[model samples]
Target: MAQLMTIARPYAEAVFALSQEANSLAAWSEELANLATISQDPAMAAMIKNPAYSADQIVSVFTEVMGENLTKEGKGLLSAMAGNKRLSALSDVSEVFETLKAEAEKRVRATVISARKTTVEQKKKLSAALNAKFDAEVEITYEEDASLVGGIKIKVGDWAIDGSAQSQLNKLGAAIAQ
Candidate 1:
């Protein structure tokens, strides 16, 4: 995983820089996301990994699948990846690019898992709190897990706050066992 990121870093940084220069961050984001999706498809992965297909063939398949949605710059990226045999790194490149974009845009994505659906008011309050904490705009998504028993678990990037009853109970159980 780390090696993949390391291999993908230069590609991602180059794309990010190009997008910044062109003032097309959103467009590049969409392009990279689409390319990543296509490259990550099981069938496509098989094709990309197989030695039977030439670089031109791989580029042709990607170009056809992407159709008119792909921009000229995106096509160039595909050609470069194909030539470098780095098509498999598209997913990592997309992830790293998104991280760069989010940092530049001063935005953070958060996920909240709760025992039940959260009310709109609760979500708004949580968003506000996260915004205040991160000093950036917060985009939150919510999921419900009944096994949580109660309370909530919030994850923002590498940081996680697990306040779920199930988590607390597990910790208590471990302590008691010790």
Candidate 2:
């Protein structure tokens, strides 16, 4: 996964630069998402991996499947990746692009899981706190997981705040056993 991400970083950065220059970040985001989805499809994966199929064949099939959805630049990206046999990196590229977009827009995505559904007031307060903590606009998604027992866990990117009762108990158990 890390290697794929590393391979994708350059492509994502180049695409992001192009998108910024063209003022088509949102459009490219959508196109990249579609391309990623298409690339991940089992049939498409098989075709891409099959040595019997040439790069041109793969590009033609992908273009046909995307139909009129792809802009000229989108087609160009497809051709470049296909020519380089790096189509499998599309998903990582999309993820990296989204991360870049979010940072550029000063926004962050977080998921909050609690033992019960959060009240509107609680959600608003948490969102505000997250925004203040990150110094960016927070886009929060709330989920209820009874297994958490109580409190909540907040996940933002690679970081997680585990404040649930279950987590506390596990920590206490480990400490006592030690």
Candidate 3:
């Protein structure tokens, strides 16, 4: 995972800079996402790893599968990625690029899991809390997990706050056993 991030960083930065320059962030974002999905397919992976298939073959298959309606610039980017043998990293690049773009737009995603269905007010308050904590524009998604029993679990990026009753019970159980 670390190596994938390392390999994807430069590509993400370069694409982001180009998007800023061209003011076509949306187009590029969609194109990269589609390309990433294509590159991640098992058949594509086999093709990329197979010594029998040439780079041109890979590119040809990608172009054909991607259809004929793509912009010339998008095709050019795909060709460049294929030529450089970076197709396998396309998904990683796309993911990191989306994160970069979201950061640029002052948007963050937060996952909130609660014991039961939450009201609109609850979601709004949670979003407000997360926005206040991170000082960023937050988009919160809510989920109901009955196993949690009570309280909530909030995750933002790599950070998680597990205040779920089940979690505390498990911890207490471990402590008692020890």
Candidate 4:
């Protein structure tokens, strides 16, 4: 996984730089997401990994499938990846690209898991708090997980706040056992 990320980093950085220069970060983001999905498809993965298919053949298929949705630069990127046998790294590249985009835009993505559905006001307050904490614009996704029992858990990148009742109970159990 680490090696895959390492392999994808340069491609993602280059693409991000290109997008910045072209003032098309959003377009590139959408395109990379779509490309990552297409590349991860079982059929596409098989074709990409098969020695029987040439780089041109793989790019041809990609172009045909993506059609008008793909920009010239996108096509060029596909060709480059196909030539280099890096098609499988599209998913990692897309992930890294999104991280880079978020940083460039001074935004952070977060996920909130709660014991039940949360009110709009709750979400708003959470978003504001996260924004203040991260010192960046916050984009949040919410989920309801009954297993949480109560309270909520918030995750932003590698940092997480496990305020869920289930987590507290588990910690208490561990301490009692010790």
Better candidate number, 3 or 4, judged by TM-score: 4
Greater TM-score among 1 and 2 belongs to 2
Cα error of candidate 4 at position 44, Å: 2.0
Error of 2 at 54 (Å): 1.1
Looking at candidate 3, the ten consecutive residues that score lowest on lDDT are 68-77
Score residue 2 of candidate 1 by CA lDDT.
88
Candidate rank order under lDDT: 4, 1, 2, 3
Q: 68, model 2: CA deviation in Å?
A: 3.4
- Model 3 ranges off by over 4 Å: 67-73, 174-178
Q: What is the per-residue lDDT of model 1 for residues 1-178, given as tens digits with 9 covering 90 to 100?
A: 8888998899999999999999999999999999999999999999999999999999999999999999888889889988999999999999999999998999999999999999999998999999999999989999999999999999999999999999999999999999
TM-score of each: 0.86, 0.92, 0.84, 0.88
Cα lDDT tens digits, model 3, 1-178, are: 7887888888888888998899988988988898888888998988987778877888888788878656677677667777777778888988999998988998998899999998989877888888999889998888999999999999988989999999999999999999
Task: Write one digit per residue (lDDT tens) for candidate 2, span 1-178.
Answer: 9988998999999999999999899999999999999999999999988989998999998899899998898888888888888888999999999999998899999999999999999998999899999999999989999999999999999889999999999999999999
* 2 versus 3: better lDDT goes to: 2
User: lDDT of model 4 at residue 93?
Assistant: 96
Residue pairs in collision within model 1: none
In model 2, the clashing pairs are: none
Global CA lDDT computed for model 3: 0.86
